[model samples]
Target: MKRTLHTVWLVARRELRTRVQTRAFVLGTLFMALLVLAFPVVTLFAGASNAPEDELSASDSTTRLGITQSANGLADPLERKAGVDRPAISVRKVADTETGKNLVREGELDGVVAGTPTAPELFVERHVFPHLERALTTITYNNQLDAEMSRSGLDPEAVRDRAGRGEVAIVSMGESQGAADGPMAGISDAEKAQRLIIAMISTFLLYMFLIMTGQMISQGVVEEKSSRVVEVLLSTIRSTELMAGKIVGIGLTGLIQFAVIGVLGFTAATATAVLTLPTFTVAGLLGWAVLWFLLGFTLYATMLAAASSLVSRQEDLQSVITPVIMLLIVPFFVGVSVLPTNPDGTTGTVLSMIPGFSPMLMPMRLALGGVPLWQGALSVVLSLVASAAVLWLGGRIYSNAVLRTGARVRLKDALRAS
Candidate 1:
């Protein structure tokens, strides 16, 4: 037992060392870290383009405009009327209508308002600013409505009081507001983006790390067979020991890389949260991401290591391992495309319970705050059990077939090999 334990550690250590020393591993880790950091930075700048400007301006930034005396009445009396403060305009009385029109044309005035109190007209060089037009129309209506109402023998103040009192307080009911006041209605685009970013980044990295390390282990196994490295290693340790050591070694290396990227992503999420980009609580999502990454890596890496032993030549690697890669990839796209909108929907619920897929899908659902503790715990337990079964089968296939060479060895033949 002691010798076997020592051999596994030896193999794990060798694989970890060999992987870290490579230029590709070191550079790839940094590149992925930078990619994680870039997400929030891009999000920050992207929102600015859609933001409203701080200062509102119109007609060369002047708030003062001219009002002309019309055929029916002058605009002066309504200019100082009470109880109106919206769309503020400073009115200047113009003696001559044609002079006011020329002032607007000469850019000395914003525009000239000329007409009866009931029907007002604003003249600018070519066109009036839309907001200015609306404001002029509203103020004119208010001024004319009161006078018009008084002339009809109605009490204007009493009518105003009745109109203002008609406003009803709307309670947040689904049918009442057309979903405007629902529980989910308050979520901003940034919050939605953050939720998606968390879900996607977690699932995507899991897929990448699992597949990359899995292929590395497959390649390592084939290298051992082709270069007769297994014969030399076997002299000191049994085949199972060598296989155990190599998988553990490569897995530890993959875990370290995964952790680095996860930490960077978690940090970016924290910072983005300050900018109002909501994330799952740092401890909650970060912990699950790391947990799922390790579990996902273990399950896939074991199968990939076993699959590698079936093929002696590098050219045959893709044919044997493509299915395992697809298993990791399918759940990733599902989590990314479907999980955000329907975290607890039919797809997420079913996929999160599956052993292979749960590793990628559950962490996303967890961030969406849809999965309960029992469900997540159940998924983890199933994954561990699945990992154990895969490990046992992987150990057998690899131990039997790692020594064989030439054409690809079939799984059934390898399992039955004496």
Candidate 2:
């Protein structure tokens, strides 16, 4: 047992050292790390820039002030006030109502506020953005309410006090309802959005990294076989040990890179409060991502390793492994795209349970804090079992085909070899 492990370690360590020293590996790893660091930062900035914008042309300065400065000048709060996303609005006073209407009709402005504060008429052909309409209604109603309050002999302070009293607090109770207890529970809308995006991005990374890394492993097989390196290594170590070592070595490199990306990206995002819910925790999701990455690599790397053994030359590599690549890539995209909206939905749940898809799907579900303990456990077990089976199969293929140097060895011939 020790000898086998030592041989595996020797092979793994050599591969790791060799790859790490390469300029391509170093540069690529650095590039991916930078991307991870940039993802959340870019996401936050993009959200700010992408907020819906509404431009309203008012009749005059007074009307524009009424629209923007109503509700005790509480129309625009730069910070998130009550967890709802607010759009950006700019109000400009025009020379006349007709001009404002023209601007609106010509698409220069979103709408025109022409009538009085009490009975303000928002003139627009179509209400494309709801935020504009809400802003108009809110300002108009506040101005009207203030007028009614003034008529009732309440001073500005008293009107403010009354309005303050009208602002009822909203309490989100999920404990009793059982709606918020899972991944989505107790998290703010911002947090939910962030989790979804993070999950999606992580899924993308997994897909990108796994497929690339698996391809590298396959290419390594072809390279070693074509160059007759495997024959030399075969004299000293068992094929199983060599195969195990290569997978482990390559997997470790990928894991380290993955860890750096996940940890740094997640930490930066959380620190920036990019999608922070009150109960937004990172450790759990981090573990989930790393675990799935390992499992995903196991399933893919082994199968790809076995597939590569079918072809001796590097050029014949693509044809042999294309199906395997597609099998993993397709599910990864689907899991990332669809799981966020319905983390606990039927499609996600089923996919997460299946072996090939589980590696990607379950992590997405985990990222959203939506996966049940049982589901996660089952996924891990299934993936591990599948990985073991594939690894065994791959070892057999590698052992059988690694010695063959001609055209691609048929699967039947490889399996029948002693």
Candidate 3:
């Protein structure tokens, strides 16, 4: 056991050292950190841009309404007489009716209230803009109210306050405001959904790390085979020992890379005020991330190590690895496309329970919110069991196939050799 552990450690150290020394790894780390930082920055900008602009547009059939008088003076008189807070109406006297119509069409003027020798007639070139519509609605409603109050012999001040009363509160029984409020309440209605997204993103990221590192493991294995390094290494170490060492070494290397990225991302988020990291909360998101990350890395890395041993040639890697890569990718898209809608539904439950998919699915379920302690515990237990089985099976496959050269090894041949 001590020998196995020592061999694993040695292999892991070698793998870790190789990665840290590589230019690709350094560049990849920088790229990923930049991307992580970019996400929140982009989100902040998008949120700011989506805010409503305070601009108004109004129009009538043809004539334009020019408050030929001072806007402030008109607003006060209109407020006193009609009990309406009319917005500042500026006048633009054009050459003729056509020019006035042109200005209205160009959206330079709001509604043109044409003062004929008779009564006033309003004209708009087209449909109203939202801000203009709202402002118009308010002024019109107040004007009508003032007219009604004048008929009823009520003061305009008394009428305006009564008209602007707050709306009635209607509380429903057995309904959560969080769930019922529209998409805006997604944080509350779909806290679980948010959590699921985070979990899936994290899991997929870890899965990707394993895949990249696994490829490195495979390349390392192939390099040794091609260079006749294995022949010398085998003289000192058994095949199983060598395979074990490679797996442990490569996994540790992957974890170190993961740790660097994770730390950078976490620090970036906290420093940028994206996420608030707490001191001592047992179920805090950061704590969950740390726990789930370790579990996810361990589970995926074992399978990747095993997958590497299935082919000796670099050219054969795509064929041998396609299925395993698909296994990692399918759940990722599924989690993103399907899980949010049905957090506790069929997809979530099935994927979370499945041995190969549990690492991705379980965390997603938790993030979408409301994974019971027992369910999480069961998931962890299942993942551990699955990891053990894959490791055993994969190790056997590695032991049987690592020395083989030329063509890719079939699963049947791998199993038969085992």
Q: Over the full model, what C-alpha lDDT does candidate 1 score relative to the true structure?
A: 0.73
Summed over model 3, clashes come to 19
Question: How high is each candidate's TM-score?
Answer: 0.66, 0.69, 0.63
Candidate 1 local lDDT, 1-418, one digit each (tens): 9878987898889899989999999999989989988876776556445532112231134445687767224344434431132234567888867988888778778678787677777787655355566555667778689999999999999999999987654332111233223234444344456656666767777778888888898899888888888888878788888878887898888889888888777777466532333232545566777788778877888898889889888889999899888888888877778877777688778889799889888888765543555788889999999999999998899888888888899999989986
lDDT of each: 0.73, 0.73, 0.59
Query: Candidate 3 on 258-353: residue-level lDDT in tens?
Result: 767666665665454333222121134444555555666566655665666667767776776677777777767776677767777876787776
Candidate of highest TM-score: 2
Which digits, one per residue and each the tens of the lDDT, describe model 2 over residues 1-418? Answer: 9999999999999989998789998888889888877876776667556552212211221122222222223334211221233334556666667777777677677666666666666677665445455555666677777788788888867768766786432222211222243334445455577667767877888888898789779988999999998899999999889888999999988888788877777777766556443333455566667788889998899889888988989889999999999989789778867787678788889888899999888877766764556777888898899988988888898899888998999989998887
Q: Which regions of candidate 1 are displaced past 4 Å? A: 52-192, 272-280
lDDT winner: 1
Q: Give the TM-score of candidate 2.
A: 0.69
lDDT of 1 at 50: 50
Q: Which ten residues in a row have the lowest lDDT in candidate 3?
A: 52-61
